[model samples]
Target: MAFGRNKNRRRQDAAQRNEAVKGAVRSKGPGVMKVLALTLATGLLVWGGVELRRWALQSPRFELAAVSFSGLQRASRVELLRLAALTKGQNLWALDVGALERTMLQHPWVKKVEVSRRFPNRVSVAVTEHVPEALAVLGELYVLDEEGEPFKRVTPGDGLDLPLVTGVDREGYVADPDQARQRFQAALEVARAYTKEAVAGKPERLSEVRMEGRDVTLVAASGQEVRLGEGDSEVKLQRLARVRRELGARGLAAEIIHLDNRARPGWVAVKISSPVSERNGSAKQ
Candidate 1:
């Protein structure tokens, strides 16, 4: 009987061990399945990403269709495209916008530019060119932009019917560019103020703006000169027009009008040359 009991005990222990092994496997089965599923998903995502990129780059749908340019003053579209090294039928996604902008800036006229990629295979470029404002006589005549930068040498073929800015020479400009720019800007300011006023009921035309060391002088198209010392430019210009009108009423022509009175506002000294007698006299108002 004892021998029979020992055999039964061994059978029960073996069954218990078998159950424990089965339970452990069942607990780990879901974890293993989760890992396999996660790996498969990651592989699919990577493959999809690569395929999408490839399609977008190489597909005809992304091919460049239209290229639009705006704010181009002197730069032609063909020239701009040549500078950009870009053409239509190329892939839009393949073009680097920043590289193209930097390239376009080398056009010698473009100052500020923005290149962009539009949706559905379109590219747009917006450019701002340096506009010619005045002519600077710096040994060699050069063109001055609005920002007082002397950009290029004046050519005969260029339509440079602009106001002449004198007094800042090439030597002085090369020595101190910042100070030279201030002189140019001062001349331009006088030019701007002169454009607003009329003389003797006719439109005032500016021929030259000369910066004469802390004083600005304007020579009109009619050979009349006006000197503005430092500040109150617009007011001085208005006063000049009034003086010209008063002189015109008396049948007298003003050779020069001095408004350079910092101490005395509205004080003007006029040099008159009578057209009838060619006599010159000084008048203060």
Candidate 2:
């Protein structure tokens, strides 16, 4: 009976040990699962970070693919195209707009230029060209645009029908081009006035235009000299036109007409024809 009790006690202890082993195995399985889950999450995070970086790099961000140009004068399409070609394929976000503007302004024909970027691959450029109003005969003839800025050198045989301006002082020429332009503008205004009157009447009737300080002197077709004061140009022109019309209608002749005084009636200087005695003496009889 005692031996039987001892063997039963041993079997009970063995069963308890086996149960403890099973519990340990179950606990270890959950710990391993947790580790695996953590590892998987970490791997997923790494992969996502790499993908995000690649997406950022590969995204079609703003790059210069198209260049638009405007405000260009006197520059041909070919010249403008050449100027724009330098910025092709450049990243618009990283591009230096000021630098690009300077580049265009460096071109011979470009007077003023502006550069801007459009999103997703476009660059826009606007430029103004120097237009010449007169031919400035320096070392070489340069065409002075309306702004009086001299731009290009004139070549022999170039058929630019521009007015000639002489007697520009060296200081005026060497100073700021804007100053030169101002001179050119004043001269251009005078020339335009002369041209308009000539075109309306007999073109050859008006000869040369000589500009004095705030004054213009004109030699008419009838060898009469006229003086006009500056400003009130339109009013002066109207008065001159009336005088010419009256003289033509009446067959009246004068050596001079002064429209300098708008408040007074038209004034004239008469040159009496050579007396009959003097004419006969000079006649080739």
- Evaluate model 1: give its lDDT: 0.85
Model 2 lDDT at residue 16 = 97
C-alpha lDDT score of every prediction, in listed order: 0.85, 0.67
- In order of appearance, the predictions have TM-scores of 0.77, 0.56
Write candidate 2's Cα lDDT for 162-251 as tens digits. Answer: 666644654667876566566667777776777787677653355445556557666655566666755655566666777667776867
Provide the lDDT at 98 for model 2: 78
- Lowest summed lDDT window (length 10), candidate 2: 265-274
As a whole number from 0 to 100, the lDDT of residue 265 in candidate 1 is: 69
| Candidate 2 Cα errors over 4 Å, as ranges | 1-63, 84-87, 155-159, 175-182, 192-209, 212-215, 218-232, 246-265, 269-285
TM-score (C-alpha, index-matched) for candidate 2: 0.56
Clashes of 2: 8
* Clash statistics: count for each candidate: 0, 8
Instruction: Give residue 217's error in model 1 in angstroms.
Output: 0.8
